[model samples]
Target chain A: MKPVTEAELHTYIDGALSEGARAEVEAWLVAHPEDAERLRAYAEQNALLRSLYNPVLDEPVPAALLAVRSHAWRRYFAAAAIFALGIGLGWLVRGMFITPQMLPASLPRLAATAHAVYSPEVRHPVEVTANEEEHLVGWLSKRLGTTLKAPKLAPLGYELVGGRLLSGPQGPVAQFMYQDARGQRLTLYVSRQRGEPRDTAFRFSQEDRVSVFYWVDGNFGYALSGEIKREQLLNVAGVVYKQLNP
Target chain B: MDRRLIIEHIPRLRRYARALVGDRYVADDLVQDTLERAWNKFYLWRPGSDLRAWLFTIMHNVFVNQARRRRYEIEQAMEEVPAVSVRATQSEQLELQDVDRVLRSLSPEQREVVLLVAVEQLTYEEVSGALDIPIGTVMSRLSRARERMRQLLGGQTVMPLKVVK
Candidate 1:
């Protein structure tokens, strides 16, 4: 027999009232058609609210708005690139940093490919020249922080033409070269403190037409790259790991 | 997983942020900062969770934190901030024209509950979590907001008081 309060009426309209409360409101509304008009206004507002915002879902998502697969990968790369640049710039400016490996992972791969391209020369091979192999090895050793050996490649059919000291995130890296009798060449890309092992196996990656086999262990990292088969590449990795780790 | 995936949600997040913050530039900045912070802290993101909600939660928190730090700035400019205009198609209905004004007239707390419940169509529980309020409080706020809207809209109401068997 009691009239429904405004609060109860609102809840009752929204279907939030308890079952008993709902039934009570229903019985009261039947006796009071005037209250029905009040309910209609709230319902109209709710309807209009839904109508106003619901179209947002139906709006066509602009192509530019999509998080494309490539975009995700680019973000991944950009993060890496920024991290690398930050570390590099920090080292360049302050010279005080946490660890050498804080240098970006991608930079070594670039260095490795560059090593592969320039290591072989009957004519013009190394920039610093290989006649000072010991100086090259010694200088890079002090910078990279482990003993350096230009790994031999006779089993893979190449001769140690020698090596060059190059700058890396860790400071200086050694690029050791070996050439076959027919003039085919392979480079043993060694960094004293290359990095913590990435996935801990020989990963053969190609940038352009050049193939690179890069691996890392507790002490150092090595990349032996050339135009080679997967098995041949892994075989190169095996030889480099043996000469470096052994 | 990727910053780009999070970027894809930027415009929607921006729109939502604009609605919530009532400033276009601030909303866009909130979205941009949300994206940047989300990118930095992404390693903490779980694989299976809802990224949109995650982004929204981050944006919501960032807005709250910024508001706290800049409370003086907010208070000084509070009265000067322009009122928001809701975009709705014009119709012959008397309610449509004033609905936007009526909705805006509600207190911010009440307006949030009404918009999230009625416009966003979120469940009471979800709105409670999103707004960080108790479910009971959510219901009360929602009921209060609806009642206020009803009063403003010429006291006309249409939702049924029917019992479901």
Candidate 2:
């Protein structure tokens, strides 16, 4: 064995070296008596440092030092919830502003106003007679640039009382009225815009208790307005959507 | 590792913290800080893993970083004072205080390695993780620190002078 380096001496004291290294260092040190004494002194110092600090672990931890549950977790969860809500709201607003899918909400208000204005008719109800239904249909078709067919109201026990030319938010509207024997009335408002594509389902939106069933098909939009039961409105809307879309 | 389980280990953490930092108040504060960090980032911990080691790692890092910052701040503040040269004073008794003085005399890195290995009794693997050092580095650091501690203690005691005619 060769002379032990200072590193090997330290490793020997700390018991970190392999057995081969230990044996080599040990044999080398046995030949060097003075280095052996120094090694013994180094070992004692290591032991003494250990003994001095080891008692700290046994000492009672002060009550103040313990890790207790904190209230900050609530704040963290609240912050996460707020972040999610903000993202959701931003998406909803963006969808509403940028797409026609959200146009239903605004339709009910317009429908309610249109119904209030036209339902009080006494004498002049329709612009043309049902006897001149063909001429009236042809005129409206030319003016609206789309086919205008009145919806059948057979299921509701009402005849086509009359229909008149009216104006609504989108453009010129065709208001078709229906009446039962009890004289309860309902109105269907129709309009057209080349850019607003046809929607194919009966979508009811309500404002001030008036239900508006509005739909689009190809280049025309139809809105039926009435103060009616939800089921009755849906039934009328069903007929309107089926006739236009079909 | 949820904090409720980690919080349950607070007694042991406090004990370890006290052992690491000599001052009881500083130890307690370190433990509290460690707990606060763990609780705030509790979701960051995976469900099944070593919670105790994870917590100790946090605690050890917080202590080291804080110690380094405090040292730097003190050094900056003390720069204006008249620099007094420190000379070792002979003490009458060989008490734990003497051992503490010897330990403090070692380089901070050496003291950390020595304490983690000897006092805390953490394995080389745990010490590596806690200190953010490689396992091999931990082994070498512990070996060197042990040697340095031995030399400091040897110098403190009065004995027959070695290699002096």
Position B137, candidate 1: lDDT: 85
Best by lDDT: 2
Q: Which portions of model 2 miss their true places by more than 4 Å?
A: A2-11, A15-22, A33-35, A70-72, A80-246, B1-12, B43-52, B72-93, B135-144, B155-165
**Superposed Cα deviation of residue A89, candidate 2 (Å):** 19
Candidate 1 at residue B54, lDDT? Answer: 75
Q: In candidate 1, what are the lDDT values of residues A1-246, reduced to their tens digit?
A: 987776677666565779888878878777777776667666677777765545544443332232122323335545565577785674453343332223345644765567656854557676444566677677767766777766767777877776676766666677777678877677777765543443233444565555676655555667777765544555566666666655
Off by over 4 Å in 1: A1-28, A31-38, A55-246, B2-15, B22-26, B43-52, B66-97, B156-165
Q: Rate the local accuracy (lDDT) of all candidates.
A: 0.61, 0.63
| Candidate 2 structure quality by residue, lDDT tens digits, B1-165 | 123355345656765665456566777888888987786677777767777778878887787788787883244324422332223335534545556655555555666677766655566677788778887777677666655555555444444323221
Q: How well is candidate 1 docked (DockQ)?
A: 0.16
Residues A1-246, candidate 2, lDDT per residue (tens digit)?
577777677667666789888888777776786776677766655565567655654554443433243436545434555577686775564444434242345555666677777676678667775667677777766667677787778676867776777665566777778777777777877776445463333455666767676655556666788787654665666666656545
Docking class of 1: incorrect
Question: What would the TM-score be for candidate 2 when compared with the true structure?
Answer: 0.46
Worst 10 residues of 2 chain B by lDDT: B80-89
Docking level for model 2: incorrect
TM-score to true structure, per model: 0.45, 0.46
